[model samples]
Target chain A: MSLDIDAVKNIAHLARIDVSEKDLETYTKDLSNILDMVDQMNAVDVTGVEPLSNALDATQRLRADVVTETNKREALQANAPATEDGVFLVPRVIE
Target chain B: MYSNWETVIGLEIHAQLSTNSKLFSGSSIAYGAEPNTQANEVDLALPGTLPVLNKEVMNLAARLGIALNATINKRSVFERKNYFYPDLPKGYQTSQLELPIVEHGELFISVNGEEKRIGVTRAHLEEDAGKSIHGAAEGCTGIDLNRAGTPLLEIVSEPELSSAAEAVAYMKKLHSLVQYIGICDGNMQEGSFRCDANVSVRPKGQEELGTRAEIKNINSFRFVEKAINYEIERQIDLIEDGGEVVQETRLYDAEKNETRSMRSKEEANDYRYFPCPDLLPVVIDDSFIDAVRGDMPELPDAKKARFVSDFGLSDEDAAQLTNSRPMADYFEAVVADGVEAKMAANWCNGELSAWLNKEEKDVAESPVSAAMLAGMCKRIADNTISNKIAKEVFEGMWNGEGDADAVIDAKGLKQITDTGAIEAMIDEIIANNAGQVEQYRAGKEKVFGFFVGQVMKATQGKANPAQVNQILKQKLAG
Candidate 1:
């Protein structure tokens, strides 16, 4: 499937990205090329092939029915952009 | 708008599975954690970082699938959904695109006593992205990675909902089932569970679907219902005005009660969906499925049945009690502590529930113990404590002072069951309310109630009601 110029523009705008006219023409051609490769995938018969949802085919593992975590406050709050004691700090809004 | 335009609605709900860690990382999924503090290098997508799937999340997804009567696929794979956003620390999101863990399940949800079979298209496991903090600065946007990489089970449904009520019903049904399974905590206020709706309208008997818009990130159920209704009307008006309904993702302004277009609808939101090179395909074997099935607690349906048959509760009462696992568990524990099932269910659904709500406390944090509640009921049954005293004791128990026995004793709330004591009160009442006594003797039998009220007031509401009646009747007849 070849990419359409309108399709490229729509996708970029939906993604909240500004694409220049020169870049748009280039992407139009590049996306068409990529879609053509994807079109080849459509040719292969996948009637029986299952679509995968995860990497492992193993059965789901079970955790012991117990709480493994309790406290890690300092560690958890270590990366805040701003901190007051143990809590995160955001910009004050009200007067 | 003609009457024949059938509304086709379906929902894709993202429920954050109640796992301790992220789906593919070791970061804590604890709510209210400091921003970016719980995140590790993997969550931050630092160089050479890799994702390792949390096994408990898989079990949770399967447990939900089993409850929904879905087919658990033995094999599933993760793919990269490529998108660039500040909240998405990873350049692309790892999601289940092809083989979802559960598929082709059906849920029978009842809406106002009308039952409908809604199909579960698929339920897949994925990781949540961090939240973007917008509208804060004049031109700056910040990202909070506290919720980054939390495990999410994306449950998608078929377009079987024909009305907004059905859509909301489906959501409610899913919400209850997930909570019942103990997979998703179902805390809508805390953003643990959320819903996105895909809605479209078409001419009657049209072979192809009409243009549909995806309404994203509606956390509350009422908003979901209203947003769908508003979007449907918007589409109809657009079509009537000879305007094409643009396919796009939109956000609902709940305050405004309207949906505004956020972005134009795309044929696909291309994350350039590709197989993630980092992770391997997940293989689910029978043993894993069996273990998950074994780990399954008594679900809502089974609990409801037991409540009806064993506890002799009505179907509606049973349904209400078992709608939440914690409430149902509390009811059973109260019964186990020797309260009559009917009485146990009553207090649990009534005063106990009211106390929890009034104090904004969870049942797990309830100060009243099952044994204490049962003992309180026993006091009421044994004529040891008056109903009024029982309520007083209940409050004491709610405050963690003590259970029925201790509270009743400490407050001297025991019933005045002593015949001598009650007889004395009755004599005083008969002497004082001479007119009422005369009226009773003159065949105004209803005046007996007035005499009883006087006796109760004389005793400070502590006299046993049955004993008061017996003594009053004997004296009045004499």
Candidate 2:
């Protein structure tokens, strides 16, 4: 239920976030407090109560299978940092 | 490849649902569209956008589960599979993890005439990430998000497959079943249907499973078999060399027909799956399952059984006819179009199949229609053309000459059934082949075929074979 400095660093790396060495201890303490609060909430006993996925007590709304969207590549790609031939460009990722 | 070793393989097959729109968004899911043209805002995972379930996707998934006799989870939850990839714009993939939509299904695969039951662990609904086109740009990867949010049914098989051939048989059976039920298009080259194999090997009598290496994204059936074979051999070699098999992901290179480690995604196991808060738990009822079941076409097994019982076809012929929906329908249509059951089955499974294989075409793509074939078979039934001449007529029909009657008339292929004319021709053939006829009359019974062949040659293979046989026997006795 607690986060250590190395665990925090690993999480930061997985999320692709940069954390200065000085801030690691502080981030660890903050994340540990958040986990503690989550652990405290988990202690509540409600065996018969249903877990709610959304705030509204409703099942997922079903949509008819139909395409309503048209080509708007220009507008959608307007905010992209880099694009080429109507595709978003990023650093080369090889598998 | 070792006799003392046993290979255990499990398959994860992803079948893209044939829908007009993306799984959760209203974007089009058509293949080969211009890059990003169909990437709607919801598929891009824009802030404040929520996903809604496509009713058709659920119906198809449920249809598959019903066909497989799987338990449909009434309340299935969607979870987010967290990962980092250029093609995944949401930073996580919306997939079913803990509460998959279907579970505990089983399918049978036949290898070497022995049926093996393969258990389906579960099937889940998931959204596909976009395409990352490598080498599309200089020093960069180009991402096309049109495929993002596309619906996929990830069917996971239990690790019971013992060899590459068995794995392939299982895959083919599943492939035909999905296409039979109209759930997937099953186009491997286009990525509509893809498979991954988890392979491991152990000593023959050992019970505990060895570490498995997952070969990923094999798109073709051939590639699947080759990849599994290569991986098995690799594992056996590694073990024999006193090395250990690492449980990691590997990629199959079709060019080299080999598999290599893809170490980049080895940590892909740590997906940290959690409930996707945006999509609510989908609840279902018996009525939903019933509706899906009603719309499902007859499965391959049921159709094969019907072919056997109703048409009196042999087990092998029935199986061949029902290998695909279109082929089964084609066979039935031939029978319904006035050809007898056994004749229809013969032409369908024999000559028609040979022509289709030679032309590298599906039964659906055959130039000769079912009705056309039925018409041709009727000629043989009525003694208008012998089966030998019918092949020539069939070839003519396949060449687009016309229907059976037209081809028969054009090629002068009508069977010679007149008793007097055949007798005269037999007399002439006996006159020509005097030595052979003497040998036949002197108790050389096999020379009778020579006389029949000569008579047939004179008639240009148009003589009815039964009449030829009877007359040759009668005339040779004298």
Candidate 3:
């Protein structure tokens, strides 16, 4: 599938990236090339084969349901850019 | 005026699993904790943090699959649904995309005595995002990551429901089922169980589906019904006014009882979904499935049938009793303690239920124990106390008066079956009410109630009503 400027701009907006007019042409070409390369797998005529979702065919390893971790609010919140009263603060989000 | 439109509804229910820890992290999953106290490094998406799948989530999901009679996929994959929200610490939700864990399930709901089968498309495991507390900080949003990484089983239903009532019934049945299987707590108030309803209206007997709108995060069953109804009417009104229903996500303002568009389709976020690379495919062997099935409790439908045939309860009573697992357990406990099934069912569904409703308590939180109720039922059955006196005793018990016998003794509410005492009262009533006695003997049969009432009043209402009637009838005839 071919990528247009508007489509690229929409994708950039969804990804929360700011795309300028000068970069739009480059982004469209790059995204289209990526899609085309990924679409190359469609050339195989394996209609009945099940699609693979994971690279490793291994089953998922399960952990016990116990609460092995303790409260680390102070340590975890140390990485936040902004925090107040044990909450990570952000710009006001309106519904 | 709009008889040409038909409402079609389907529901997607997100039930938080009742596990102790988060789905993919070791963080504690307890609710109502101090803000951010439950968030660990893994939940915070710190560098080098990896997610480990909890085994209990699989067991719980398998239990739900068995309960719904769904086909359990042996292998299921976890995918990353990418979205930008302040609540999502990882910037993507780990959910099952194309291959859900359970699929092709069906639930039967009765709407106005018409039974319809609602098809369950799939039930997939996903991680919940954190909470964004608005209006808490001055012109800012505060995020609590306590709910982040929590497990949710999103059960999606097919577009089979035709009305608001049907959709509500379908939701109630699914809610009860998940709670019954012990997979979810089914607490809508705390949002452990919430639903998003997809509703659309079309011309009657039309084959093509119309554009649908989704009502999001409706937490109550009543709101589900009301929101669907309001949306249906809105769509019909729009179509009749030469407008088309726009596909969008709407928010149900429960206080106002109306649905307003949250965002139109063009502004909808594209949740670019792809399989997660961190986690492998979840594979279940036959033995694991068998163990989960073996550990399953009796489901609601089976319990309802057993209640009908084993206890000779009416279908309505049985259905009511088995709607919740705890209620069914309470009823069975009362009967197990030697209370007659029919009488026990009556007291449980009647007086006990009424008292519970008044106190706004669930069966599990009932103040009166099953043994206490059985004791009261025994008194009523053996003529120790009349049903009316038992109600008064129940009230006393609820007020912490004591057990049945203590309440009866403290209140002097026992039935008086003494024939000699009843005879004395009857003779006095006959002598004093000479005019009424003459009226009764002259063939005014209704006056018999007057003498019985007087006898009862004289005995302070302790007289056994049947014994009072017999003795009073004999004295009046002679």
Which residue pairs collide in model 3, if any? none
lDDT of 1: 0.81
Give a tens-digit lDDT track for model 2, residues B328-404.
Answer: 99999998988888888888889999999998898878999999999999899999998888999999999999999
Best by DockQ: 3
Cα displacement (angstroms), candidate 1, residue B347, comes to 0.8
Candidate 1: tens digits of C-alpha lDDT, residues B1-478: 5476767888999898998777776667889875566766777787798877777877888898789878998877788898766667787888988777889998888888988899999999888888666544444455567687888899999988988899998998788889888888899999888999999999889878888988998998899999999998888888988999877888999999999987542444666787787887777789989999998888788889989998899998898888778888888888887788998888888888899899998777888877778889999888898777677889998888887888888988889988998898788778787888888899999998888888877777888988999999999987
Q: Supply the TM-score for candidate 3.
A: 0.97
Ranking by DockQ: 3, 2, 1
Counting clashing residue pairs in each candidate, in order, gives: 23, 0, 0
Instruction: State each candidate's chain A TM-score.
Output: 0.55, 0.82, 0.86
What are the lDDT scores of the predictions, listed in order? Answer: 0.81, 0.91, 0.91
Per-residue lDDT value at B233 in model 1: 89
In candidate 2, the residue pairs with backbone N, CA or C atoms under 3 Å apart (3 or more residues apart, or in different chains) clash, namely none
Pick by DockQ: 2 or 3, better one? 3
Model 1 residue B149 CA deviation (Å) reads 1.5
